[model samples]
Target: MDELSVKASSLGDNLSAPDGSDLPEPRRDFHDEQYLSQCSLKSRDLLLLTCPNLGLQVCWFLLMSSGTPYLESLDISKSITSLVWLTGPIFGAFAQPIFGILSDESRHPWGKRKPFILCGASCVATCFLALACAEDITDGPTNAPTADSDSTKHWYTQVFAIACVGVITFAMQAYQSGVRALIVDNCPPQQQAAASAWSMRWNVAGNLVLSTVGFLDAKRTFFRPEGNAKFKILAVVTTACIVVTVGLVSYYVADSSQNPRGKSRQPLTKLCWSMLCPAELSKHWNQLPPVSHRVCTIQLFAWVAWFPVLYYTSTFAYETVLPYNFARELHEKGQLDIRLIEHAELHRSSSMLYFAFATFATSLLLHMIEHAMPAFDHTQPRIWFFSQCSLGFCLLLTFFARTGATATIIISVMGASWAVAMWIPFALISAEISQPSPSKLGGKTGWILGLHNMAMSLPQIVSAILCAVILGALRWLNIGDGIAWIFRLASIAVFYSAYLINKL
Candidate 1:
């Protein structure tokens, strides 16, 4: 919930003062006395603030699990649906920074980030609703005006589905930016690592929701379970979660911007300049505490592995299952049907469920390990190095997987590192910025976090490009199976990232 930000009492116009007189903790006692008294947060408070992430995560998983298939159901070609997945990376690269800047500068009396979050969440919810009712909305509950009605309705639904996905992609970027900013803005510096762990915990919960929903038979519902009924149920659950979690933090958390005056927009020229050549941000980049830079670099490489693996996991599961189930032979013999695909996808859902539990268990186990073996944690400084080594091994292992269960187990073991990847970087960055700085970092929380998000997204683009080039070269040369090379290359990248972790 509130884990995205630390304490307003701990934070302000400037996170620290020069001459080392002020660090993340201390403030002008006399001036901040009343504010700190009112705004100081407990562990429970941080939990409340971060709760919104749960709903946001559900929205994310829904898209990953259902977006393309939903479009396919509308009679859209598989090729077009595959391309639709690109919208997230493309929009994420641009949207996070823009929204971060806007949210940081917001002077809304209600709060700085909540207003943007509200707008974005509303739009996302609306899009989900539209997707859930695409057919009914495009045509009547029963429409058969002419012989051409089926084609006309399918066309309408196709366009409607695609449009909704586009809106959801952009809106989610804005919403996520705001929520992340809200978290960084509110939590105390001391709890960042815990916050990161909590973020992963919530992510696991979202995965559970996806797995549970996916496990349900489409025919399980009482009325019209064939078409969009499941999506409708998911939409209702997602909307309710947003209202409850977001509404809680919005109503309970104190306003972040102490400044009562309205935050005004910058001139277009200045805004563009800030985006293109932010001199101030560049200075901060250079001055970041040692660990922050190393973590950022490592994160970049880690995502090189993650980008392909995450995007391809469902396909990987399908393919892996097909070989074991004899579906591959059937396909080779030109026998394809809905049942065969469904059988394969059933295993995909099982893989996701297995991975979710692994991640959740790992997230919890890490904390216990830290407490039980303080000296071990000291060796890697937050077990980051350990995570990298395991992560690299897991990625490398993917290339040798020959069964659906084997692939699933590999993904599950990856939880050991995935837990760290989710929270450690954000926690590290937040801590670094909060420490005394060589440059102006005050009120730049959003931009700094935005840069981190950009780092993650940029890798997706690179990995996508590299995948294309590698695949193309393989086909051109008529080489042996090149798909395995993807994992090998990803493993190499991860090991290098692990090397960087040692530097950290």
Candidate 2:
């Protein structure tokens, strides 16, 4: 969120010249320049490089909406499903930082970020393929699906699916660190905000595409009977997209680094351990300036409010609005009804569409704010504060949302908050840390980006751990569906998060 007034001089100094020149340009275009001033890359060029996010978002939305339900489809117990729900946050918490440090330390010929990005994309694709074929691989005598009479011989498939999820989640986390670091490593300071905005916009666009696909697939019951074929197709489509986009980006987009070969560190293991170690991080934490502290704090509060909503909205809506005949179907047929699954899928996709649409609108709103308020780094604390409050109020309305439209509308409004939560904190933190010395920040971009990711992943882990207990307590209180109350509690967190913005 760099102020427009002071950007030209700072951006020029921060950006390197083209044609291997050491000199910085007198001024650079905030809108036109992609990463380097004299480099031919435009913002649209960077956008094309970032299209891999489209694939990532497609896979992510599929997992979030369908992963737990897939476990249930395998007839896995609630306990395992709940544990599986925690996988992304748990793996992400560790994987992102490790990937960050590795990318920061990498000296590959392709570039620091590209190698990790390619590797991560490959691993994710492999895992998705395995997941897509889970049923086929596990259809032997020990793991084959059974009839209604006997216990289903599908627990083995369930195990395989969960394993695939774990591996995929970790791989995606690795991919995320590299993808996010690409912007930091390449984009000049002035365009960082625009970079973040475009990334978010692309992210929402990806979400929108997947949501529409899911909705249509669900409506048609594209995968009949067990309804797992759609996921297989989704996995295949997303994997292909990942490989192509990541490969294209790797091949075409050169990283704008003056020093392509950074000094190699000591033992890789020790460096990774230090990066992952809380004790080691605390040392660096103590050295950071106040703005850095504020950014992290805001991230913590904001994500604590956000992660639960992201993880549980589908579950909550399924349980509350689309309550299917799970018990009756289970008792009579020893499996949940396909109708129930279809209903949930429809709701999940429809709700996601609204979420994406609102995110698009919110992005525009943020753009207006940035243009209108130039001095405060294109962001006002009060505006962010208001957005959070509005989100909390919208979450409050979730309690009364009876129909699908009601839920969609409420969550759509929550998008404004999500936009700010996702965009501003990263912009603020990156800007704050880059100010002391842009070159140093460039060297540690991956590390700092990793720390910022921790500010996101850590809260998700906390929320995942606490969600069951909170929902259980709500159920004990005998309120109208404890599952639905998760949204209400999240609203409370959002409100408190707004109060914390004053400190920023």
Q: What is the lDDT of every predicted structure here? A: 0.69, 0.68
Residue 409, candidate 1: Cα error in Å is 0.9
Per-residue accuracy of model 1 over 1-504 as CA lDDT, tens digit each: 121232364334233333423345444342342333233345566677788888888898788776666777777886577567667877776678778777767667767688888899999998888888988889855544775887787788888888888899889888889888777666545445556666667777877877677766432333244677777887888887778888887777655554312336676556545655768546555654566666666778888888766666666666666643365456678877767666677777777677677777887887686557755324434477778778778767766788778878877777557667776677777666543331344556667777677768778878877877886687578654355567667888888877887776
Taking all chains together, each candidate's TM-score versus the true structure is 0.84, 0.83
Alpha-carbon RMSD to native, per candidate: 5.8, 5.8
Best by lDDT: 1
Q: Give the C-alpha lDDT of model 2.
A: 0.68
The best candidate in terms of TM-score = 1
In angstroms, the error of model 1 at 122 is: 1.3
TM-score, structure 2 vs. true: 0.83
Superposed model 2: Cα runs more than 4 Å off:
1-41, 141-153, 256-262, 322-345, 368-376, 434-442, 475-480
Worst 10 residues of 1 by lDDT: 1-10
